[model samples]
Target: MGRRRTVHKKLPAHMHRKGNSYYFVQMVDGRRSWVPLGNDLAIARLKWAELTNIGDAEVEDITFAVAVARYRRDALPAKAAKTQEEYDRALDRLLAVFGKMPLDLIIPQYVRKYLDERKAKVAGNREKAVLSTVFNHAREWGYTKAANPCAGVKGNTETGRLRYIEDQELLAVLDHACRPLRDAMEIAYYTGQRPSDVLKLKRTDIREGTLFFRQKKTGTALRFAIDGPLFDVLLRITTDPIQIPAGAVRSLYLIQNEEGQQLGYRALNYRFNKACKAAGIPDFQFRDIRGKAGTDTEDVTGLGHAQRLLGHKNRKMTEHYIKERLGYRVAPTPKLLIKQKKRA
Candidate 1:
């Protein structure tokens, strides 16, 4: 028979090494339990000891599950709804792959593998970038001390394709569109504002025949005077005693239906695409009109000015729009010098 083991009266609230691995042996009075360190035994023991010494620290292991919960509650902001939603989705992806591993077990290599697996499924540079951001935030919050798993990870190098409508197609579509959609399309063209922003225009945003509003996406305040054609279009669409519901009465969207409710972006996109088909406009997209309008107005407002009015955060975005709208191609302009006939 094996000899009876002796129980210590008091247990040490620290981790210690056992043979080749580390173990966290905890004892509260006479009760005792131990957990093994899978791979990072040394580092795990040090972390466990440090946390225990910091009085009032919870004894439970800090798992990825706990860290994610903290990220959702303490890190994300209320105003950034879209960002929060994306973070939640990314964290869910991480959890599915890691399965509630200890927080410290999430090394850069593990993150890299997770990203690689996700890239195979989603196949977008943006998704990879978002994943990188999430892991970076995790590091910033002290959930991990390892290098970012997404750091130095290269993504597919393809740029997005630009789709635009020809002038004739645009004209045809405009001629066939219903009043609300027609005004919406025309305003998107003239103002170069995104569909979401255009749909939120209020009658009050126009003052002395000029349009002014703070862009929601980029937070840029814009002011621009409208031309006669655009002014006429606005006058045609204006409504008296705006009919929005009492709950949304204070909202300042200039474009509203008979009920005074602003048109939803998806609905507007669907209707606009339908309008294009009805008008027999081939290869036309709603966003193309904005680019076309900006190109046509380039002389009046420089490319930079148009880009700012469009609420583009960077010049490269403006350049892409300009290139697509104007069908611009860059080539070296050769410089030729001829000895002017001194005789002349």
Candidate 2:
């Protein structure tokens, strides 16, 4: 697509004509800095006027920290709760570097310095992304007119770092995992659901043979047939007399603590990590089980079914799992059934 400059036929409210050209009498540095609106009043009135309308008074004192706070209160809530938390954490790291700087003063050079000093590239990249959003919001709010500093910055590659949980790793984790942790992992792997989602699964979500709920992150209503591992495990948990504790009420959740409370991520991680150590397994995350579910049965059920299983909005996410975690499967070399003749 070709870029087209927009033009507004009429001049804006603050703009006035000086000699042959239009100019804006707006505040800058606590005074009116006569900004040249340009000879073509139409284009200047459309493109520049919309993204930035900050007066000099607003620009004089607006700092990066102030912009971040506004973004936190106003723009952050639209994201998922988990995503909001992650972005907030990344924003804190950015604030540490440029909290005192004015919004317009934070240029690409300063951002590049921050990226270079940071050892963890993925986290740094996320911080850059969050800062970019903050600046964009600031522009819309008429706080600053600077371009997004994160526009051209590239994040470090995290390829080949993620690996799927092998069957042995599963056995090890299960052997040492508490009942709640074990149930969480099992459900996550079997259903190809996020561990976060699995941790919140309630017993009431099951009806007949189908489990249904709206996923927290995506808000997509999910319905999965409860069969195979999911069915067998849930049946045992509900029907087995020994599995139920004496005098304890059956929990409302499928994967809750002994007190029927939803399991916290920190507590689950600690227990899962301890179990992994006990089983002499390497550092494989429980979340990696999601990737295993995508590839393990996909050869038979196909990618579409696997995509649905993972609750991915698209197949691209599922494909990333198959390639990043599983890598490509090596096909068998062809062989001749009969003896080959001597080369001609």
Candidate 3:
């Protein structure tokens, strides 16, 4: 019913060339749907057969690119902004390797090979996780009938961060921090909250002599009594004179820039890194402050106190988090044993 293409006349029925690329044309719901079969004629022919073979009609055939597009449309919107950014980065790497491959053809061996070849082992693990999710969604969408290929694959080994900021290191870094950075650091250190939680704090979060925190990552709600160092930090934030930039209203967030805008992640990271560089403490990160709080709390009080401060669900997790920072000390000398032996 359509005009025969004069150019690429040698192309098979239902196949057409547009620019440099080939397409497989099918009528779906009475409208022509053009599925991309890529640019190479030989590979396009192979993909065309995969799509149109009578024996394979029962199983939906689509490339990983198509499936990823569908996934980005349907799934990525539901994730948090930070998580979406992480997945987007992973997806870019995954698409380069498997984009043209048929979704059902992506086997476990291929997944393993990709992981082995990737130079960034830790980042490869994250990309593998994103690929696994794509396969899962592909199955649900009927694009593939096979089980997810990434299920049994073991990712590269990764160790937890073990750096601890000493008291002098903290003081040095604090000396170089700006007003907003100082406030953010003290809040993070005293409350033992994540950087995200610290930035999200507002005047409304404090009520009736207690500061409340609802962790963004874990949804763990914590309440800290307003006392001691935490109390001093909060008082400073409240009593300090804030210089608002022209045409910018005061921010609802506790941490704000000179412009009176809520401190964003990029700004916060830049300022913290600059301060660290100035202090000559390049190894220290803003996150290590939380660990310091936990370690110091455990030393002064006990493990339970540390667990509560860090908002960990259990003491075991708290122990693992603080163990590296709890540098070894000689066990108390056996004075009681000596006394018992003397009496005997």
Please list all clashing residue pairs in model 3, or write none if there are none.
Answer: none
Kindly indicate the candidate among 2 and 3 with the higher TM-score: 3
TM-score of each: 0.66, 0.75, 0.78
The 10-residue segment with the lowest total lDDT in model 3: 52-61
Over 4 Å off, model 2: 1-57, 240-251, 330-344
Worst 10 residues of 2 by lDDT: 2-11
Report how far residue 39 has shifted in candidate 1, in Å.
44
User: lDDT tens string, model 2, 1-344?
Assistant: 42232553233345667777777666778888777767753444443344243333366699887677666546676677688779867877877788889998999888888888889977887788888889999999888888888888776565545676778778877998888788788888788777778877777889878988677878888888888787887886566522545677756677767665677888888888888888888577877787888888676688788888877889888777676766676777688578878998
Question: Candidate 3 on 1-344: residue-level lDDT in tens?
Answer: 87878887555568899999999999999999999999975567666656765223344457886676666656775777798778877887888899888887899999999999999999999999999998998888787889899989999889978988899999999999999999999989988889999998998999899999999998899999999998998888888836876787887788988888789888899999999999998999889999999998888898899999999999899989998776644598766654444564
Please give, for residues 29-60, the per-residue lDDT of candidate 1 as tens digits: 78866676544533453345444543232424
Cα deviation of 114, candidate 3, in Å: 1.4
**Could you tell me the C-alpha RMSD of candidate 1 in Å?**
13.5
- Model 3 misplaced regions, further than 4 Å: 1-59, 327-344
Clashes of 2: 3
Residue 18, candidate 2: how far off, in angstroms? 58
Would you list the clashing residue pairs of candidate 1?
Answer: 201-254, 202-254, 244-260
lDDT of 1 at 173: 88
